[model samples]
Target: MMPPTSSAPHSAGSAGALLTDARLGKKPAPRLRRYYLEPGLRKELPKLHQILAVDLAHVVMLAERGIIPATQAARLVDALRDLRADPEARLRIEPERGSMVLQIEAHLTNAVGESDAGALSTGRSRIDQGATVRRLYERNGTLAVLDRLVALQDALLALAARHSRTLMPGYTHLQPSQPWVFGHYLLGFANKIHRAFVRMLEAYHHLNLSPLGTVGGSGSPWPLDRRRTAALLGFAGLVENARLGRDIQYLADIAAAACLIMNEINDLATDLQLWSSNEFALVELDAGYCGTSSIFPQKKNPIALEGIRTAAAQSMHWFSNVLALCRGMGSGDLAMRSPGHVDAVFETTADMTDLMTGIIETLIVHPSRMGARAQLGWTTASSLADLLVHQGTLSYRQAHHAVGAFVRHCVENDVAVTDATAGLFASVTGLDMALTDAEFRSALDPATFIAACTSQGGAAPEQVDALLRAAAADREADRSWLDTEQHRLASCNAELDRAAEILAAARPAGSHHHPDLAHE
Candidate 1:
């Protein structure tokens, strides 16, 4: 219903009263249900209602029939089942003079039960139903995105394994500071993605709790079996209080999940953009994933990466929009009908999944180019500084300062550090040492330096292998989780199919007293 309006009382005795008394005044227009439900959501609106009505009708019928205890019919179960069957459902909101009313309209194409009572009767309010639908959509939506995230991780792991010994120049301040295996570098981002997946799982768990039975931000007089519906809809449990179910805290939790997805996508896009730049050029995106320039035929822009970056930024902004929406509303303003959070969440989540999957699937790794670049640019110079510290010739601070001076001298004089003599080293650092050409060569070899690092996450091939094995195991676990979730969803859908048939068969019967009764 539209926001409340103002009206003044008229004196009953005059001609004005007679003129005004002919009818109960014009009825307010039905606020199109889709205005709140359809703007950004992926699921169609009508289908959502069909699914919801059927499932809830079954619950109502069972309760009416005494086939099951009233406690077995949960609003959460009905909402969940409805979403699975038809992600888009529309309900009617009829506002009278003093109070608002809700009922599901009959005779729609998807309508199964002919009995108007099956669709129109509601022991609960639309506020709880809407909240429950949003929550179910969010929880499942995140799980779907998480599946893609883990798949991308698998792709990154494969890249790391393929390039475990492929060297690349690792930079600080846009200049080469050290050399590392490309696999080692890729694994760093993989770890970040892995953590993002974990965050998604945490959000999924929180969203899984059912909020369906709460009526108008308070408990209803009619008994609502919160837990049984939770089980039917695959929710772990209920959030308890009706008001708490639609509370700001619950909305914020949903928003937090959206932020997490956006952040991960932004981080990925940023890395891809930097790596694809001409200045870095350690890797070139495949032409299939790049866009052509309007003026420069030679320019191959990483538009997908850039688009992903922009989309992620936009999603975060929308998350803030929803948060602000929450701030503006009252503690129990259930009638506001701002399901923007649901729409925003589904759109952002779907975009994230598409971007993550696209990036991983089409990424082009150039091990040879990365290795050639790594070997150039004096990237091993840092090793020389670290070597001096290891040899106890200087403290790390002294060695750092000495190396900085040497780098400056070589850059100014247009000379290579390898060409500098042992006497030059003595002159620069005042170390009483006579180093040979072999020593200079050894210090400049990045492969030698990397191999010496034997730590858990080091660039050494052996260490990379160990980490890769662990990541592979984790990926397997992630796959199993996805499969289990899919199976559960499939079971929910199957139940809806059966329930739809039962309702369809019972529609023609004249004597059925309840929504859930099976047809003769």
Candidate 2:
């Protein structure tokens, strides 16, 4: 299925046409309304209804405060509830109405007189409405991204647990540098994703503030209770600075968090792509995640991973677009409120996170091939140097030089480090000391190399196990955060529903008019 569109309500062609016709003294071109304007409204209608609900709650608050007459507020609330209850039957926007708000106002004016219907927008503007909707959209989107990230982290931790001692070749500059287990490698990704999750939560905290009371980048003339509206909307607090409430800098925070996530996915994809190649032959993707080439029957392409890589790149482009759109725009400019651009970034980043999670969860590892490759690259040379240092036979630098020379001699003589003789090491180190067969084997053993790395954040099995346990705890914390935010949003929506119901009940039944409004 296609992802959701922006939360900003589109301008209705009818509203635009009526205004333009009044100013120009002629019917506006039908093509613009039919092709450009109408289609946009139709696409945005679903999310626009959500913004309408928020507006209704604001109107109810106005009534309670005596800012608008209680009778008028009841009529407006009833109409709003009727429209919201059966949006397909009651909410309509023709080329004569310009927006969802205008459409609603027109309906209410026709249903309960112009004075009562018009009062619904007493302390609100399309500008602040748009900003508020975007925040709601972002708040929802951030939670979604976090949910996927938490799942991805869990998947990684599970995979890492099973492969704690599954030795693999760790690389530097695309060349094998040392021996490490698959578990340790996966833990690295888990740690990175954990950091991304934390950053997203930070961004979520910032975006959850309400901009409802800051109508048109300034406080409304009426004494609107910003805090009450914010509480009703599930926002943590007001944006405080009315002017700053409309700024698009929050989009930058979102973009930064998304970029961090996609970049991590890109790195993981690169590694998987390399490992799945014939040259590496270290991993086998599940058939569910792979595709066969149309022209080559033997080809089992990692198409899913390739798509993830491409999605990561696309997210970067979308992030750049958001940055550019908000770069020079004023706080309340239309450019600062480009919901479509910002939504694209969120959608793409979330897509990649889900895709990568699937890849990690299902991909098959080749432990034998990984171990064989790990042993082929003289990956234990550093271990030998360490052994030399620990034995008090030579300083670290001297041991490093000795091991370097010994590796070159083995390479030149077509001898594997595991098969080299004691005489060979002595010749290279220019020492008269004798080395035992057990010592030679231990020095070249991948398992020995991995076990010896017992530093705080090392590849040793014990260290990896510790890291894995810590990551599980971190994942639990992230899940708890997601749950808390979800409950907050749901409770806010429930509160709004209750408030609307109360206002609607104040009016007598059947007092409002019903029209066969088109669902535009």
TM-score of 2: 0.91
Every model: Cα RMSD to truth = 7.5, 4.0
**Tens-digit per-residue lDDT, 1-520, candidate 1:** 2322223332321102312145756433334323432232223342254336434644644454444444333332332344344332233222222122222322121223333323333444555655666666566667767777787788788887888888888877877878888788767777766776777677677777776667676676665566655665667778787777665445566566667767777776786689788877767677777899899988999887887777777776655766677777776574245444556565666666676666666678777778778777778877777878888768888888887787677778876745766567667667644457578668778788788878877878899888888778777778788889888866865654565445434333353222321110
- Runs of candidate 2 with Cα error greater than 4 angstroms are 1-43, 86-90, 336-339
TM-scores, all models, native as reference:
0.79, 0.91
lDDT of 1: 0.61
For 434-492, candidate 2 gives per-residue lDDT tens digits of 56877777778999888888999899888998999999999999999888878977898
Clashes found in each candidate (C-alpha, N, C closer than 3 A): 8, 6
Q: How much lDDT does each candidate structure score?
A: 0.61, 0.78
Choose the strongest candidate by TM-score.
2
